[model samples]
Target: MKNILQVVHFPQGAVEDIRFIKSTNMPYAATGDLFISCNTSDIDANNGGYLIARLDKNFLNGIPTSLSWFNVVWAKGYAKAVHPWDVTNQGEVYYVSGESHGYDWSAMYCLNSQGKRRPVSNWRTHWLKNGTEWKGTPASANPFGQIDSVNYSGIVFKITGRCELRSWNMADFSSVQSDGNGGTRKGKWPADFLFNSPCDPQNPSANSPGYTGYSPEACCPVWGLAVLQLIEGIIMYTWE
Candidate 1:
């Protein structure tokens, strides 16, 4: 594997995780590029933020052509999802959970190419137990269930140690269900949803770079069965 990009922050910068965004509808970054979720030198002023590493075919020495940085106004750390939404007046949305920074809440945030940030509350989240509305999971109550961690593509999957694979409909942030025929149809949250083991649900996966244990697969439900089968095969072989 070749190192395609490298980010260096002087004095104090901790690179947490990295994601690649495909072509999007955003004006500033219309092409595909790389993004990073990391802690800058100043946490209070540059805490929960991400770096846009514009990839260039000609920029030499494995470096990004340019970098644009933005931080979530109130996020301390541990942010995920930098997906581009066609709506939102030309902006991208991301989710930040307090789980990493020692807070018990998760939320979706939006950012424009101009570095403007805002907390969004457009989710129809009665799917949560207490039926909390957006601006995120209710502070301290987390009606949806404890989110050990979350992964996002077009939809967000909340993975927990309880052997759960809860999904949130991103199309409208409403409730959704598998049609029992491998397709998704409208359904209420908690109800109409299927429950199954996403991993050794007993072994909650950690995303740390140095972590070297059983990592649960973070895949869309469309291929969930295949991933589960592969993981089970690994587990069974290891046990044998």
Candidate 2:
């Protein structure tokens, strides 16, 4: 039989080459049950771009398959590019870009069996900030830009059906100023008391030493998941 295959093009560009492919030996035991991640770039632009494709065995035989593409646009006067990471059987993929706009960060997403993309909450909106000086050796100076200087602050938003979009402020954080009206900041604070710090033990002057500014509680949902798991474990152990 003649080989018949389908091809699709992304608005940004087309898939250039297949970089790597791996099959799982444990979770699922099937030949075509494989994960493929590749690179796609703008042919005309010639800077750097990336896309990902997860193919089953049938796809290798020329069947049409859905692919996910991510493109990075460089800011004015900035030369940069984005790169894609390897794919995992758990339907998760990650991408990083830095050459664009003189800064860079990584994004993680979960792919459904149908190839639909879903954002991973914990890894979402995570900027590649410089590791704390106490953590380890000082990281090499980021060529694109510093994470804090490039606005690493993020906001967590809930979407329908437990989905969410975590977005980070892409503007330069170094220059961000508090809204003159402190009472209206978007945190768990009363409108009447915006200038004071609830967590401040010393009650330092506004913007003064010992005055840790308004810090909203971490919106991490992992704690809730852990509690639920603990309860389940206790019940199971008690039955034993």
Candidate 3:
């Protein structure tokens, strides 16, 4: 990893989780790069946000270049996605649920690269950009881009947990088959998520370098996964 990629921040905050997102459009559809989808932690002026990390090479080359940044999302609530849509630009993320953030609880926000959030009339109705702006779920809701000729649809499974996979449609943010399939149900998935990216570190007091930020949790610096991508699909780790 290059020095630039070593330790980076999300504006005036720290990073919570990191995932490499790929592209989903035409020419770059078949080719995907390793981009960082970082969840931000409150620190000083920075509260919550999601920033994309960039590099000269799609993947990482230990001793070559550094890392840069791309589009970002800002919100005081936990603005995190279930999957990395860095370049894909299509997917949905679950937000600051008390179940996940311990104390904070807010509405689930779904947005696009332009930073425009999916407008929902409560939780049962979503407004689209075109057509019926107050009817169905938009394509940007699906983290996997599209599924079976459909955009806001796919089945996701936990990496390591009690398997509970289901066909997800962004329409109402549920898997309960709406059209006799099953209708959205109580689907709560869990897994040991590993984040490998640079972030702000807290001192013994669990604050930023200058005690100028809010710690997401009592735990100061969040350190878990840190691996180097040697090949397109091969990953090498440096567990710190």
Model 1 residue 214 CA deviation in Å? 26
Estimated TM-score for each candidate: 0.33, 0.32, 0.30
The TM-score-based order of candidates, best leading, equals 1, 2, 3
Candidate 3, poorest ten consecutive residues by summed lDDT: 189-198
Can you give the lDDT of residue 37 in candidate 1?
A: 39
- Model 1, span 126-225: residue lDDT tens: 2333433322333222343443221111112243322223223334224455767997754333321233212232254323121123333444112111
Q: Write the per-residue lDDT of candidate 3 for residues 135-166, one digit (tens) a residue.
A: 22344342323322231221111111111121
What is the per-residue lDDT of model 2 for residues 193-225, given as tens digits with 9 covering 90 to 100?
222322221221222121234322233221110
Clashing residue pairs in candidate 1 are none
lDDT scores of the candidates, listed in order: 0.32, 0.31, 0.32
How should the candidates be ordered by lDDT, best one leading? 1, 3, 2
Q: What's the alpha carbon RMSD for model 2? A: 18.4
CA shift of 93, model 2, Å:
2.7
